[model samples]
Target: MPPLAIMPVLRFDPAAVAECISPLPPLEHTTLYENHNCSTSSTKVLYQIATHHYDNGVFEMKWGRVIIICAIVLSIQIASADTLNLTAGTYETFADNRTVQITANLTDSTGYPVNGTRVNFTTDLGNLSASYNYTNASGIATVNISSWDIGNATITAEAPTATNATVNMTFVVGPVSKIVLTSILEGTVNTTHLITATVYDKTAWEFANDENKWRIMPDVKLNFTITPPPGSTYNSANITPPSNTTNKSGITTAIVRLDKCAGTNGINVNVTNEDGVDVHESKTIIGVAGAPVNLSITANPYNVSANGIDTSQITGKVTDVFLNPIISTGSVRFNTSGNIITKPLDGTGEAAISIGPSIFTVNVTVNGTYLDEVGNSTNLTNETVVVFYTEEPARIVVTADATRISTTDIPGVNESAITAAVIDRWGHVLSNRSVNFSTTLGDLSSTTAITDANGQATTTLHSDITGDATVTASTLNDSGYEINGTIVIRIMNESFVSVITNIEPDPVEPGGIINVTTVISGQGNITGTRLAAHAMLALDRSGSMDPDYYAGTPLDVVLVLDRSGSMKFLGSGPEQPMTDAKTAAKVFMDNLVSNAQVGVVSFSSSSRIDTGLTLLHSSDNKTLVRGAIDGIYASGSTAIGDGLADANSMLVNGRGDARKITVLLTDGVCNAGSDRDCSNAIAIANANHITIYTIGLGSAEYIDEPLLQRIASETGGTYYNAPSSSELRAVYN
Candidate 1:
């Protein structure tokens, strides 16, 4: 670019220049434009002014946001009339050419309609064309939509210059219908399916005539596409449509896919029209989550049944590799070739369906799953299964050591070879079943010799002084059960005595009370069935003060002695000094159960309430109590509470019995509750339900002489005592 030259001149028209600073007589509003601040522009005011020419004269106006209105005309400003409003008729909209219209809404400052003004219109999305004609005196306009863009668009119109006023509008472009959804069905696997779609004009044209409109396409075809869930890959090639219908919807089905093996398919299709429209829609098909069948059992448990004189039992668990039940929702049945008690079917979890004696055959039939819930499995295997049962070694378990002692001193019997064997109801020895024998000596070292399948054995007795021996049988199974019972016989050398019978319900139900008693006895060891159990002993201290207290306990004894007024007559020595009687009484306490659990009670018109139950303990308490007993000189008459009401209550609450027992030595009859005839008291004692052995010691006192026998018989306890001094020296043992 070279040098350029420019020239400037000023020929001011006062009329024109003054008009810029002045205004027409004020109408509604006037817009002011001037060149007075030219110093900021570094130029003359006239040089800074902008000029616009109307049809005749030129005027000075400013470019700004203010709208200008002229109340009167200045010079020959050209004015022509144009329709301010226009309405056009509707037409059918095509995907391509959607029709449109335009008009100007114009007026003078006085609100009178004016025409001959130019108007411009446009849209936010594509191009728009409109006729820029002056409005023909109306104040309205109409416009039509014609476009393929499937989204929203805003249309606008405005007048010329900074005074331009524009109106915007939005219209719906569709009921986009060409995209259609259809269905197809297939069984499974590479199953090919054919689908058809007929693409039509999306716009419904209300205005049409017997003229050439959108007719059948020369060639209609559409491309098919599909998208799958993330991480769920699918093949696009399988969705390819036939070549015949190009750019149109025809055999346009998507193929259903299947994996040769397993899993789920969540797939859908995407269809695109010639007009660039896309549609989407999905389905889930399953192929491999089916049930499995065919369970086979290799072993048949024939040995579990009863055979001959030596019957037996079989135990073991059966399982599959997956640990799932082979018999599905239904059950399995078993049948044996021989034996009668044996059933044709047995439920799961049981080792056998027994056959008489021993012989058995393990046959199994596996039922199928509930078909109603799950359809039959094509992979189902064999229907029959085989189970195997085997018998373990049979043994007649004996629970006693080899030792013989005289039965003379034992309270329950006159024989010493006390032992028990655990066998079936039929007398056959059970394998791995246990037979244990224990005695009160607490040495309790003995067992019923383990027998062979023959089911017979001998158990030698271990040297436990004298008491009851027991046998318990139990299996070596989880939550294995047990059965127990007792037999009493004397052990070691001692003078024989009358029998004291004590029986107990061996193993009792949970929370059940056990009734035990010493039925009859002279001077002998306190032997009874429960002695074999690690027992807690209770002795009555009712005035039947005898020199022989608990001469019968073998293991440990918890003595609960009664101290009612009747004991006053049985006191040792003449005049029955409380101190001397209690002193002589200490001698009998020597024959205690092993770790003697000694508890004492004394009753009068008012009996001693609480007496701690524990061990003889050889502590300060034992000596003090012994002193107290020695100091206890009788004064009142016997109030034989009768039966063992209080004693029974104590045992029930104590519950401290491996084998619980009470030695109720009452010499006097029950006078307090005797009117009820010891019947209710006896019932209460019976309800004590626990075994009680009585020691009846008595003089000719009315309480002792009258009811003594009844108290002894009622509690299953021994009644013993010397109402005189001379008799007290004789040891009960």
Candidate 2:
């Protein structure tokens, strides 16, 4: 046989073979082993064994194959997968040259350390220690991240040849850099002031968007304090919630109460940061002065001697609602039965007045007032002090409330108060003394009366005469010496022609014409049977008895005129509405009583107060009012409501005791502003009891007839329509 090949198979062991050959001699036989038909089990494998032997020495070879079963012990292994994990020393860091450590941990799935693996690091912000870091024996890789800019940063670590093995983390970067403090006072010293503190952090994100914008630091702590000024105690200044945390907007608030006279205070705020940041801000807060509400008065000597040279000082102290001394510029005025001298108040809110050389027993009344920066006066309570003298009556003095009285028999119209004062030899008042009163004219309320605590006795004098009356008062002193005092009262004769008017309809509607009947009557001394006197039925519709009967009441009148563009359409001279309006206004002013006050307001799309209510008693004042009326120039659209409003304002500021009247003249409908409805003007006029007399100066087509009528009717006034400019004077009359 040339060669033999054997297929390996599981068979009996070679050790159990019947014949076993010893180790083959050199070159005697050749044996070869080859694995074949291996099984799935680890302990079993097929091997092909071949033997080579030589026949004789001819160099010819013969091959023999053998099948053997192998029982082998093998070492087995399973590969482990790589893993990557990222961690940070801290999630947050400040821009104050501080940093946070980022670590990358790499390992196998079997929890075995994977060393010598390079981890690639990347970040959205801040500086990194290294871009690539190798893992140590512990399978941990680390890098440091730091930034001067404040913002958020994203960090990543990745290993090569790993199944999507990448790890990421977020780092917050910020630091408190700046603080701003501000304050505003809402009212007086006792009121509260709102204090605002803003905290900020400069960051890269903020810079990228807007360099001027600051990155707000939320949840930051802050402390607020206020430093009081001079002449004020620390207790006078208090801030509530002194410690607070900022909101999401980076702002915090505190309330500060400063009760001081007047001065500048310091407001301070400090930022509290975890990174030990020392940020502070300060501002100046000016103190406010409170209103005067309390006043106390005292006298050096309760009683000053009547000796011609004795002096006493009266002092007045003022305080505010908080009981804090008023440190403002003002004075205390002193009034008394005698002469008084006044002086300005000192910084301590005390003002002094000196009274000396008393001639008789008299009481001194002292009062204090405060003048603010705007010169608004506030009056305080009044105090009284008496100057004493010897207690013996020596002189008697008498006074009358009115030296002139009307001859009419009216109770309040012709009555006068007569008073008598009794003094001692040393000018001391003597109370409980009997006084005798006698008058040459008029009737006395009492012939004798006892003096009161003030050493004064009062009596009433009723007169219907026209001549001067001398009243005498006499009293007996302690020494039985008669002291006499006399006063003169003049009762003048009354002469007037009253035109009694009667109206069929007691209440007439606005713009309605009616007939009135007049009857002339005379009182007092009428020389002839026929009396000639001019009469007018002009009456104030605002709570006034007919002027024809009660004619002495003072009047406050405001003339409102329309200077719209249409007024200029009628041309100049008598044909011009503006010219007629001026003329009619002047004529009405000329007819006003001497005691009447007049104010002028002109409107042309707007309104202006030409002059305030001025007394017509002086010719110069009357001339000024007339000049204002003449200066009006017509232009712009018509604003009737504005004219009425301006007129109402003027009347509201007028004398409270006078009859308020508004004469509004308009040539066109209200078409310029929202106030054209005239409802606001009407409401205000009615509330103030002011009568509005509306006069339509042009044709019906150019004027809002219903609006004018409504304004007048709603305000207890009358409305008149002037079809032509010539009729303006008649309408006003």
TM-score of each: 0.29, 0.31
* Candidate 2 lDDT score relative to the true structure: 0.69
State the displacement of the C-alpha of residue 575, model 1, in Å, after optimal TM-score superposition.
Answer: 86
lDDT of 1 by residue, 422-481 (tens): 455433344334455544443333554453343333334444345444433323322454
- Report the poorest 10 consecutive residues by lDDT, candidate 1: 337-346
lDDT, residue 309, model 1: 26
Please write out the lDDT profile of model 2 over residues 173-222, one tens digit for every residue.
Answer: 35777776766733467557788887777553446566565567778889
lDDT of the candidates, in the order given: 0.39, 0.69
Say which candidate scores most in lDDT: 2
